[model samples]
Target chain A: MLTAFFRWMRLVLPRGDAILLAIALIASFELIGALVLLLNSKVSPVDLQLARTFFLALTAFVYGIYRVNEFHPLAKPDYRRWLETTPWTWRNPLPGGPVLLVPQDVVVLALLMGLNRDFSFQTLYIPVAFLSFYLANLMAINWLLGEWQLAYSTGFGLGLGGLVFRRPDYLLLIDLACYLLTRIAVQRSFRNFPWDDSHQPCAPIEASKLKGDSANHRLGWPYDSLTPAKLRIGFRLHDAICFAVLLGWWHLTLLWGADERVRFLIIALPLIAYVGIPLLRVFPYFYMHRSPIDVWGRIANSWWVIPKFDCVWIAPLSALMLNFLLLGWASWYEWTVRFRYFEVTLPTDWRYAVSISLAPVGTTAVSLALFLIGPKLEHWRLTGQHRIVFQRSQEFTEL
Target chain B: MIQLQQVTQHYGVRPVLRRIDLTIETGELVAIIGPNGMGKSTLLAVMAGILSPQHGKVIIDGMERKSTVEHELAIRRRTVFLPDKPWLPKNRTGREFLMGVGRLYDIPDDGLIDHVERLLNVFELEKEGDWPIRSYSAGQQKKIALSSALVTRAPIMLLDEPFSGGLDPSGILALKHILKHQVQQERATIVMSTPVPELLEELANRIVVMRQGEVIAYDTPTGLRSLSQCTGPLDEVIARLVHPRTMENLEHYFQERPKC
Candidate 1:
């Protein structure tokens, strides 16, 4: 059974390195949490319990959202086709028959259990809540797939059950029972899989959907209709606004909290979520578009050309300015509020300060590096040749 | 004239073109014929300035691609390249795509609309012209791509397997007519690559035969026939030149007749 489980895992999560990376990141986060707990010996047991619960709930929420999006009926038709053909029943007598758990479910359950200080009934509710949310999402998807009668009956029953119970424990039990029943129904549905014939065609294109000439007209300074310079400015403005909002939220939530460690996390989490997460997501697109030759070509002949400068220069400069603004605001808030108002002394460790300072510096350095090396990298990726050869040959021919 | 001097390219150690030296004159319809993975597409990409060669230079008339900003722009404005699998802007109508391409070349607004309409009609895409490219079938997408290239009205065109993308017989005939018209009326230079030699036999002024990243023969259709000593169709002559052992191998396999 264990071997079969491993085989199923291997089949589903084929990218071994990705799994390893996720594991490494999770372990590192746990290590940091442990260190914070150890350093802040003044933390009350109740506060610690509350923090753990918050972390678990956050994890479950993120996992639920991912499940909802990942299992959308219309997404990944090829994968769905494969799943339909594969034999997944307990009666099939295959090696991995009756495999129910997916990687996300296993990872979330393990994390919740591992992080809980007391292994009690409350810990059991975490996985149950997660499964209930995930299964409920799948039920909604079934309705979208045209199982209207079954969907309405199931939804009505669940709603009535929730109202009648009125107790938290009973509601959780009802959620679990409903989830199990739906899981069995989904398995049976997979056996038949009637939704294959209801494939949706591509969306029609209309003139109204296109960007109009009026939209392309200049709005104001740094807001042209179609230029890459304007795009860079707009992206920078967006980042600035997002960072300011996150900063405001952080202040509102954690300003009165007495625990220094929690306060530190309050500041750090927003920075990681807003600036770091967005950078991670957008960097690939940025790198692909950062070709110097293409940028120069567009700037030279484009309708809305920036005079006396290339648009390629804008991205790196904008990135640097945004990072400076974020780091400056963070430092100001740290000094003015945390140190002065809360009487929280700056860390004597120097390593903490150095690491925090290095985050923005490192980001700026990477942006500059991308600006300098991006064209060559793009050329290499596209044509599979060292750019130096083209550079030298062009020079030789010119001479 | 378009000149490629010792143009060499590779995809990660797998050489696609090796020291390719060729020149194409103005108003010439040149067809590059080869088997799969013989660098027909790579040669066209090099000419189009879409892929920079590692060792050689591509020169259009007097201006060299990648020389300077102005020089590159000048070369690009005069040349329009249609890749083997052209990626159309998904959300835009076919008419809008053609209009966008026309605008990029600085065509007059009055001329642009007329040219777009004519191209759409020529390719039998008039009914679907107003529809978005995302909803187009494979053949329709190919027609739209061809239409966009035609709308540019550039002096030089580099097309890679323009006919292989689900084009029906009538669409192929329409494309052939358009190619001939461009060469005759506008003195446009066209360099197209195809695996099928039959398409090029009647259309091409000169045929360039490639094998394993090297150009083996560059001649007229009759010249190729005489050189290969095959008085049959150009397809047979190409098979003789590129895959001489193919017939012998097939004969041996059939004679042996191994049981399945």
Candidate 2:
């Protein structure tokens, strides 16, 4: 019966991990027993108990990592490929292993919790460590696959749990909600099996024979050019999710009374990204790449601005101007600094909007300038002409 | 088609390519003749995607070069760049290198092996072909490198200083004929940078004479001769166009009387 129960406790762990886990089980109890004997007035019993529980939690974190590594189809490219070739659907059990959290996973977590249980809420760390590790991996898998909605949901949920530091119950509730959502994410993601370009960001297996690194092949011309990994896809709808999360953090920080510098920093960090990203794009688009007929050159030669092609600059210039105008408003109104005074008191509604909404609102304006308001790339390529000139040495003394 | 638009390349603050905009259509064999340090190799390197230009895009076959994974892989498979000094597997034999390169481009084994053997005979490296690259002479190494590029059967070829790489007279003749056959028979696009324009006279569809990182003249051999107002050899026409003061300097040298 004991052997059967132990077998039931094994979820995603392989033979090596199972053996190591047995050793860890021995270590956990031995360390606790040793600490109890070695206890002194200086080392409190509570600290000893906490240390023993912390060891179990750390092990659970490792298990969480292994769980995702072994369980997720995205983690195993070979299995994923095989699954694609087979006439398999989400309805059937995966040929290799389970996708969703199984009863065995709960038994594993419950076993860890049982080992270090103190009847206090502090024992929640074991489950949190396991699930946090699991969901974090899930979040990354989704993020890499471009499921930004799920990624941000897990990220924001995890972040919110961290923010409510004192409440274990709130963390556990959020973790449960995240787990259920992850199960939904798993189902949704699995439905799109044999995914095209599903990025595998996991650690490489050192022993794999057929697998080779970048160093193995000489990625020279045409291959290098045609397959360059450097293309930037600017401002997807997912930017809105990230922008909301940043602002949400700001709101939570303010409502919960974080440090003044920290409060300002949360908004300021993203504000830099908002302003800086568009500036980087617009600057490159204009820097040396000028209109075939510049405003000054055209005004001088033809005495006309030439709205036909010159309109290309309007969106970038407007983004810049709008940024300055918004920044100027931010400066004059003293939105970020005003929060210092409300260190203990509750912030008012319009002021909250002005201060907290600054980063996201500015980002939206900038993103719209880049994505929505455009002499679109396809149109610009077919029509727009640019005057290109660079410094060339006239004196050639060589044969 | 290979299009370079507003491409600028530099080393430190010194510009090697200054806003180079050139389009080489399919099946066109263009020769880049320029003075040393005048961006001849740099131009080929940029088009080959060995180096990304600071300010523009390289569009090939209606796809922007290096823009995406598929585009890059497709471009790589179709294009082959033979640098002046190509890195060879020192431990591998010349035939092995050629076969490996052919296989890399997914050429069938039977044909690839036959092609490697034929390339070995044509280049006159039949004996050295079986010997490791480290055991070969510089000229023999160049032959193998050229053969490697040929084995790929790539539609687009970028050869930087192909004729200057310690190639023997027979090897040079073989390469010239092979390049001509590729362009004429196979309709391959080749852009090669060679200091010697005389070698490219009949082979070249067009010649771009570059001076101080600038394309001073880009036209057919005849057009270049006429543009420089010299109905002489391509070398003289390019010399007149690229270094107009060289003749004047030579005249001054000849006119001067030695006091001693």
Q: Which residue pairs in candidate 1 have backbone atoms (N, alpha carbon, C) closer than 3 angstroms, thus clashing?
A: none
Interface root-mean-square deviation, each candidate: 15.8, 12.0
TM-score quality measure for candidate 2: 0.62
What does chain B score (TM) in every candidate?
0.94, 0.96
lDDT of 2 by residue, A203-315 (tens): 22121111222123332222222321222333444454474454455345443443445645644555455556565655544433455433544444453554534667677
Q: Give the C-alpha miss distance for residue B39 in model 1, angstroms.
A: 1.9
CAPRI-style quality class for the chain A–B interface of candidate 2: incorrect
The C-alpha TM-scores of every prediction are: 0.47, 0.62
Q: For candidate 1, give the docking quality class from DockQ.
A: incorrect
- Model 2 misses residue B138 by how many Å? 8.0
The parts of candidate 1 lying over 4 Å away from their true place are A1-399, B246-260
Give each prediction's DockQ, rounded to 2 decimals.
0.03, 0.15
* Candidate 1 lDDT, B67-176, residue by residue in tens: 75556657777888877765556666778777766665667779988999988888888989988677788888888888877887889988888888899898999999
